[model samples]
Target: MFKRVLIANRGEIAVRIIRACRNLGISPVAVYSEVDAKALHVRLADEAVLLGPPAPGESYLDIERLIDAAKQTGCEAVHPGYGFLAERAAFARAVIEAGLTWVGPPPEVIDLLGDKVRSRIAMEKAGVPVTPGFSTEEPDMETFEREAVKIGFPLLIKAAAGGGGKGMRVVNELKGVREAVEGAMREAQGAFGDSRVFIEKWVQKPRHVEFQIFADTHGNIVHLFERECSIQRRHQKVVEETPSVAVTPELRKQMGDAAVATARASGYVNAGTVEFLLDKDGQFYFLEVNTRIQVEHPVTEEVVGVDLVAEQFRIAAGEKLSWTQEELSQRGHAIEARIYAEDPAGGFLPAAGPLLYLEEPRGPGIRVDSGVVQGVDVPIHYDPIMAKVIAYGPDRETATARMIKALEHYVALGVPTTASFLRDVLASKPFRDGETQTDFIELHFKEWKGETDQDRQIALVAAAILPNGVKTLAQNGGEQQSWRQPTPWETLGSWRIGGNS
Candidate 1:
């Protein structure tokens, strides 16, 4: 075990790594940017180091600064928790060269699997199903259109060097292929400076599923089942769950075997996720591999009853996997809803303001992983994700009910959140019946407004009793509370909302 470990990240993932380190009796070192001086992760760590400016490039992503911080803090290991430099193979190599343990996969695996094109080639070698695609030779539209025709219509022009829908576009028709390909190429070039674009057959109405795998230097490897992450907006997964309704036990085995094969093909180790796209006919094709612990990993942990981060630690210390595939079992269903400070109705514009009040839900089956707190200033400098609310139950129905209850209990002020919208999603027939797809948010829940008067009766009750009753009620307009602020719900008691603004 490492005497000390440096967390080279920020926000909820930083807090997550700190907790894991503490549980393992390892002193955790937290490195923060100027904007995160008072961050919750920094507050919880055994020691804190100031990296640089508020921008990620100047701080969290600055390899030299993070390495110096780890060395100065006497950390024997560096844990890149998810985002920032977590998936960067160069950072892993730097840590190893600096004589510090990299609590992640080997650099070779990161470099190989992190690149989408190389991963695709490796997956094909491993016998995993892959979509047909053509890698761009240069930032030229002529070459792009010719390849698109070869791959057929309805092709996806994607960034070869990045993910998260940053440099991706879809062309359903031939006329749009030229423009779409050029646009994707420019965007990819600007974002990744690689200019390389790839064309692939775009599957229609596919369910995004991914398996979590862990391996160690001792050559032992195992998977922690799968997560149905099809519920997304703009290609970014917004909602995720364990033991997908789309995957059966037999199907899971097939996907799990392919995931392991993909990992082993790249000589992967530590923790990673092998993503796949399952079509309507139960056929799944390899998508890409995330070379780091994912943001939605908690839902898998909730069901699998094992700590993946701790496993990363053990693996980094030269220990084998603690369990085999047969020993691992998902106990229940788990669902995660990512709450962002963005208006779903207003073009999903990011919300930035002081978080005047934040009251997260808590209970037997609920878990909250948050970044901001009461009185915290949510700026426009970064991703607007406020927190993640997860609910666990013995089955899917129970989990849905618990998630609804938890979302109802959560209350925030100042910046607008999709909490109310999320509540509506849970209550909708499609979501309840598990008819979710990648386009579910836009197809059904995109324009969700909120609940009615009957919905705020308890909010009125909470307003009637909460310590800041008057302020809470006044800010949100309860049944009998004062209406001072011009909130969206201000005139709910007076039957007014400006005819849908």
Candidate 2:
């Protein structure tokens, strides 16, 4: 086991890795930008190193700086939590070349699977079902146009290098093909520094499901089953649950086997996710491979009763998988809701402000993983995700109900959040009936305005109870004071039960 490991990321994921390291008696080192000097992850780690400016290019994404930080801290391994350089093959190679263990798949595997176009070809060759797409050695407009026509309309122009909806476009008709392709290429260049794009037949109303796979240096591999991540907006998942309502016992085995085969073909090791798109007819097609721990991994952990991060440590240490396929079984239902500091009413745009107050929900079967704390300023330099709230129960219904309650109790003032929207989605008919698909948000909440009388009343009550004097409200024909801030003694009234005020 390594004595120390450096977490080369920030936000909730960094805090998550730190806790895991502490449990295993490994000293965790954290790297922070100037803006994150006081971040929760920095405070939790055994030691902290300052990266440069807050910009990702200067701090989190700088491979040389990250390697240097780990070496300077005497870390034996580097854990690149989910974002930033987590999936960057170059970063992983750099860590290996620096004589430090990388807590992820081999760099060669990452390089093979990171390119969406290349991965598709590999999966097809390995007999794994993949969506129909076109990829050539030298891509040109003439080739793209011919392939687009053959693939039919309602196709997607996706970035060959990156994920997260960037460098992606939906082309619904022939007339828009040229503009869409050009725009996607430009966006892809700016986001991933790669100008490559590919065309694929878009499967309409498909469910996004992924299998959690683990492998070791001894060639042992097993899948932890599937996660239904169909609840999404803007091509990004907001809610994920285990034991997908759509997957049956037989289908689970088939998908799990396919996922394992794909991993083996890529010479993969450590933790990774094999994502697939399941159509209405029950046919599943390989989408892509996330060569790192997924953000929605907690749901899998809650159901399988396994610590994935701990498994990552063991695998990186050259230990064989601790459990066999038959030993792992899904015990209960789990759901995860991502809480982002974004305004749902304003098109879910990221909001930046001080966390005036924060009250995370707490209870049995409820877990809150957060990076921000009260009084911390949420800068506009990075992802807006503030926390993740996960709920587990004996069944899907119970889990869904518990999640709704948890979201209702979660509070973060001075900045709008997606809490209310998440609560509504959990309670919606489609989600309750398990009719989730990639178009869930668009189909149900395309023009959603997160306004309600109950919400207004709560805001009004909160304002009236503040220490400052209450503002006056205009009545039918005149202005009147709805209420006034009360002092401790004033609230006691003229008399008490056994004593005078």
Candidate 3:
């Protein structure tokens, strides 16, 4: 077992992994940029290291600096909570070379799965179902055109280097192919530093479903079921729930099997997620494999009663999975709503300032994972996510209802959040019916202008009539306005949203 582990990321995920390490009696180490000097994870860790400046390129993403922190701190292992260098193959290999245990899969597996084209090829060789796609070291115009004709129009050009909707394009017509190809190549080069692109038959309105699978050094693997991540905005998942309403029992079996196959093919170890795009007809295609824990891992943990971070520690320590596939069963539904500091009304532009008031929901089945506290400044230097609100229950209906209630009660001060918009989503009929997909946000904002008018108006009216300090007058003994109810704030505006008083 690792006596000490360094968390190389920030925000809620860092705090999350720290708690898991503590539960296992492991000393937790945290590294932070200047902006996160007082961040929750830094405060919670048993030991802390200052990496560098606030910019990720100099701090969190600096591989050499992170390795130095590990060596100087005498950490036996490093647990990358996710993001940063979590999926970077070189980072894993470096830890191993430094005589430290890497609490993730082997470097070779990361390299193979990190490359989209190689991952697809590997899955295919392992008899896993994959989407029809073309690969070329360098594609020629004639070869591209011939392949397009055979695969049909409406194809996607994906970057071979990384996968995040970056360096990707969709061509709907023949005349658009050349332009789309050029644009995709340019974007791919800019984003991933890799100009290599490939063509694939694009599926419309695909539901994003992923299977969470864990493997151990003893050739043991188990699937922990699926997460319905179809509700997305700009390729970012806003709402994630387990027991995908779209997946039937039989389809679950098939996808689970395929996820296991993908893991086995990669010789995977530790926790990983296999993402798939499930078409309406119940057919699913392997999209890619996330080589580390996902942001939405909470939902899976809720329904399965498993602490994945703890499991990762056990697996990396050369222990086989204690539970088998048959013993794994998700008993209920879990829904998670991400709260970002970005404002949905202001074109989702990012917002940063000192947090004056921070009130998060708490109670049975409600979990709030946050990174900020009152007086801490929200910086524009990192991802805008402020916290995640997750709810679990015996079924989706109960979980969704609880999450919506939690979002309403939750409050933040310094910056605007997506809380209300998330509330609207939970109330929408389409979401209730579980009929969302990757394009849900486009579909959400298509009518967002007029649809949110009432909510906007109601919020305004409530504020005007019931400002924090505004009082409701009451008469005593037939006297007019004898007493009043006073609130903490008498003003209503951006400034009143936060204050120590």
Candidate 4:
């Protein structure tokens, strides 16, 4: 095992990696930008390094600076949690060349699976079921036109090099294929520096399901189970849960087998997620493989009782997988709701401001993984996610009820959040009945407006009465003094719909 590891990321994931390192008696080194000088991850780490300014190009995304930080801090490994350079093969290769263990799959494996077209070809040869698509390196409009006609209308032009809905477009008619392809290519180049795009058949109203798979250098691989990620907005998942109501025991076995096959075909090692789209007719097709730990990984861990981050370290240290496929079993239902600083009513547009007051829910079967603290500024420079609220229970109903209560009790003033929206989602009849398809939001909440009359009134009262003597909390201190004074907002007392004093 490595004596020390450098976490090459920020926000809640950085805090998560720090805790994992402490569990294994390894020192965690955190690198931060200028804006994050007082971030929670930096405070929790055993050591910290300043990369550069707030801009990612010179800070978090700068491969050279990251490698230098690892070397200077004498870190034996680097863990790229989730986003920003996590899937970049060049970054992984650079870490390995610097004689530091990269806590992920080999760079070659990342390179192969990072490209959608190449991964589809690999899965096809491995006998894995993939969605019908047309892809070629030849830049010919005639070829694309012929392929689009054969695939029919309502096909997708997707970026071959990246995911997360970037560089993706839907063409409903043959006449729009060329323009869509050009737009997709331009977006792909801007996002991933790769101009390659491909055509794929669009499956209507399919459920987005994914399997969490792990492998080691010792030729052992296993799938932990599946997560239902059908509740989404703009192609990004907002709610995720395990023990998908749609997957039966028989279907689970089939998808599990296919997920394992996907890892084997790519010579995968360490933690990775194999995504699939299940049609209404019960047939499943491969979506794509995420080469690093997913944002929704905690839901899988809560049910399966596995520390995926710890497993990543073990595998990177050349240790074989400790558990077999037969030994693993899903015990209960777990659901996660991502709390982003955005407005659900305004099309989920990102919002940034000071966190005047912050409170997290506490109880059995409830876990909050958060990055920001009260009295801190929410930067607009990066992902707006502030925390993730996860709930676990013996059954789906109990879990859903717990999640709704948690979101209701959670509060963050001075910025908008999706907490109330998520609470409504969990309480809705369609979600309760397990009708979570990819278009769940489009069908149920096309014009949804959050913030009830009472809630809005409370927010207004709280903001109006905030005194000028508001003092920011002390950095690296245990005790904090409340800056609020006597006001009518305080008369409303704690345990309101969205917050407490």
- Cα-based TM-score, every candidate: 0.89, 0.92, 0.88, 0.92
Q: What tens digits encode model 1's per-residue C-alpha lDDT throughout 110-160?
A: 878767888888899889999888874454667777778888978898888
Whole-model alpha-carbon lDDT for candidate 2: 0.88
lDDT by residue (298-348, candidate 3, tens digit) is: 999999999999999888888889799999888989999999888787677
User: Whole-model Cα lDDT per candidate?
Assistant: 0.83, 0.88, 0.83, 0.90
Q: After superposition, which runs of candidate 4 have C-alpha atoms over 4 Å from their true positions?
A: 454-501
Best by lDDT: 4
What number of clashing residue pairs does each candidate have, in the order they appear?
0, 0, 1, 0
> What TM-score would you give candidate 4 relative to the actual structure?
0.92
lDDT tens per residue, model 4, 162-206: 788889998999999999999989999988999999999999989
- As for lDDT, the candidate ahead, 3 or 4, is 4
Task: Count backbone overlaps in model 2.
Answer: 0
Which pairs clash (backbone N, Cα, C closer than 3 Å) in model 2? none
lDDT of 2 by residue, 55-145 (tens): 9999999999999999877889999999799888899999999999999999889989989988998999999999988876577888888
